[model samples]
Target: MNKNVAIIWGGYSSEIVVSEKSMNGIYSFLDKNRYNVYKVKIDKKGWTAEIEGKEYIVDKNDFSIFFGSAKIEIDFAYITIHGTPGEDGRLQGYFDMLNIPYSSCDWMASALTFNKFVCNNFLKNFGLNVAKSVYLSKDSKYDINAIAEALKFPIFIKPNTGGSSFATTKVKGIDKMQEAIDFAFSEASDVIIESFISGREVTCGCYKTSDHEVVFPITEVITKNEFFDYNAKYMGEVEEITPADLSEEKTLEIQQLTSKIYDLVGAKGIIRADFIISDNTPYLLEVNTTPGMTTTSFIPQQVKAAGLSMTDVLTEIIECEYQKIQKSL
Candidate 1:
């Protein structure tokens, strides 16, 4: 019997467009013979499932039935939402309560990684090299001048719980620091001001299964903007070099660190780690619990470098989740 898979996309996020793109990319690659596919979109109207290529709105409170129609059953959920409800653990928590198997990290990991302030501190406590940063809450009172004094010039101000580099600003001098912080605060309740690290930006992805953990080739991201901002990431404005021009020793070191992080976080399925290389030393930037699935995304690029097609990689993730479910039962 073929399993019913629901691919969830779109949500209350800044990366809504990017999520839609990922959904289309995934919808085109999934193996039809192995599963019954259904597309679900989450928007202001709530979650709606596509049946026979026609959308039927679902009740946000109870996801079992389509409005007043008959109940709909799904064996698994594939989340492609890029931010907010998708990456911040809200959707995962909902699925957990329903006892539905889904791809990507669990609730705890998702929640932790979604907030950069929390994740960076968590990793730092584990002896991981991370850039120093100061967190500001929505209701907290802080001295902006004091913060600037502490971090000095050339700091990165960003929303603490945002993705795709949304609401991120690179402040070079003191004059622009407040403006950058204000910009980030406009998008999120919390913000982070991190000490800027001048170095090469790179990323590594890993696939974890019951048998083993496989690390992919590292990719060096070159962006023309001040940094890899939202435009550079999804708009095809940046250049990504797979198997980044690095020595074998440096590559192996990064791969080792990537695998170690996956184990440290107890991450299942697929995860990507972003890093900044300064003076030939790699510093952990952030960990993506649900990495992008677009054809041009880093994960897909690394997948191709591993001699595996996007379909093959995605299928393996689904099958791995299925096997885990079977074992639990």
Candidate 2:
């Protein structure tokens, strides 16, 4: 019997666009012969399922859809939502209460990784290399000069809990610091200002199952812009090189570090970790609990570089998570 899988997408964030693209990518990668897939959109509008050409309201109580004389129950949720309710653990908690298996980290892990400042600081205690950063809550007050003196000039200001690099800004002086912070705060309640590390930008993806631990090849990001901003990420302004041209030692170290972070964060499904290789040391940038799944996304590119199929990877994730749920039951 084929399980009905809901490829959940859309979130109350600017990253919804990326989430939609990821949802479509997952839909295409899923093995149709093994499972019945459906598109479930969860946005400000509400939870709804998209059928052939119509949208059906989803019953939030049971996470089901009622069509013409048929009640389609979702046996699993392949969450691709990039931010907010989905990536921040709200959706995960809801699915947990329903005892529905999902294809991402649990509520706690999702929440932990979603907050850049909190997660990085937490990981830093474990001796992980992370750039010096300052956290700013919406209501918190701090002197801009103090921040500049502490972290120095040329800093990166970004939303503390947002994804897709929306409203992220690179500031080189005090003149633009306030403006950058405001830009970032527009997307999130909190903001983070960190000392920028000049180095090659790279990201590595990893996932673990009862069977094996898979760490895809690292991809070096070369952005034509100042940094890998929104345009560089989705507007084809960046060059991505899979199996990043790094030394053997550096590559292994990065892969091992990524795998370690996954276990430390108690991540599930697929997660991607970004880093800045400065002075031959890889500094942790942030952990993506729910990475993008678009065909051109880093994960897919890395998977292909590792000589693996996306269909197989998706199946492995679903089966492993479903089996865990079955055991718990």
Candidate 3:
């Protein structure tokens, strides 16, 4: 019998609209005969599933079925939400408590990668080159000048745990440093101040299955704006070139680094690592445990370059988790 797959999207995050677009793309490519697919939207009203031309609302607090008389049980949940509840550990924790198998990284990996500061530190201990950064908490003393002195000018200030570059700022000098920190702090309790790495922005994605791990081709991002911020990322303000115009040797090095990161972080399913190639060396920027799945997102572009369709990618992720669960039983 075919498995029941729930593609969850549209969460209470800044990337909610983008999540909707991703869900549409996943739904279009999913093989209907091999699996029963449903789209679940999480909004102010809570989780609601749309299947077989009918809608069923789920309880907001407990996630129990509410609307339809016939209940629905999901064999696996394909998470497509871009930030917050989806990308962070919250939703994954929920599924963990209910013993539900979902695609992407588990709770610890999701939580670790969600916070830029924590993930960078974790990887740094593993011998990876991460940018120098300082973390600021809400209760900490405000020392903008001290931080600037340590990290130097042209620093990147962003919420330590947020995604899609929401409320991220580039402070060119000491004069505008405070404003940037305040802006980032407003969105999150912890803020990360990192020294800027001026180089080509490239991303590499990796897929882990039951048998092996595969790294996709690298993609270079050229943004017209100051950096790949919110607008540049989702609004097509940036140019993405696949098979990143790098020498074959450099490309292989980056792919190897990405594979190492995936193993180091104990990342399962699909994950994307963003990097900055500076001085012929790749510096780890951050990792996306739950990357954007929009048609134009970097992962999809790289997957296409690998000669694999998005459907094939998503199906593999689903089946990998399904097989793992069956083995445990």
lDDT against the true structure, per candidate, is: 0.85, 0.95, 0.85
lDDT digits (tens) for residues 1-329 of candidate 2: 99999999999999999999999999999999999999999999898999997999899989999887899999999999999898999999999999999999999999999999999999999989999999999999799999999999799999999988899999999999999999998999999999999999999999999989999999999987999998999999999999999999999999999999999999999999999999999999999998999999999999999999999999999999998999999
- Badly placed stretches (over 4 Å) of model 2 are none
In candidate 1 the C-alpha lDDT for residue 100 amounts to 75
- Best candidate per lDDT, number? 2
Rank the candidate models, highest lDDT first: 2, 3, 1
Given candidate 2, what's the lDDT at residue 31?
99
User: How well is each residue in 1-329 modelled by candidate 1, as lDDT tens digits?
Assistant: 89888889998867788888888888887898888888899876678888886778765554553734477677788998877788888888888777778897888888888888888888888878898889998787888788878887788999898888888998888788778878998888899999989899999999888766779999999988889998898787899999899999999999988998888876877899999999999999999988888878898889889888878777888988877777777
Model 2: lowest-lDDT 10 consecutive positions = 66-75
lDDT of 1: 0.85
For model 3, the superposed segments whose C-alpha errors exceed 4 Å read 52-55, 59-67
What is the overall TM-score of model 2 with all chains considered together? 0.99
- RMSD to native for every prediction? 1.7, 0.7, 1.8
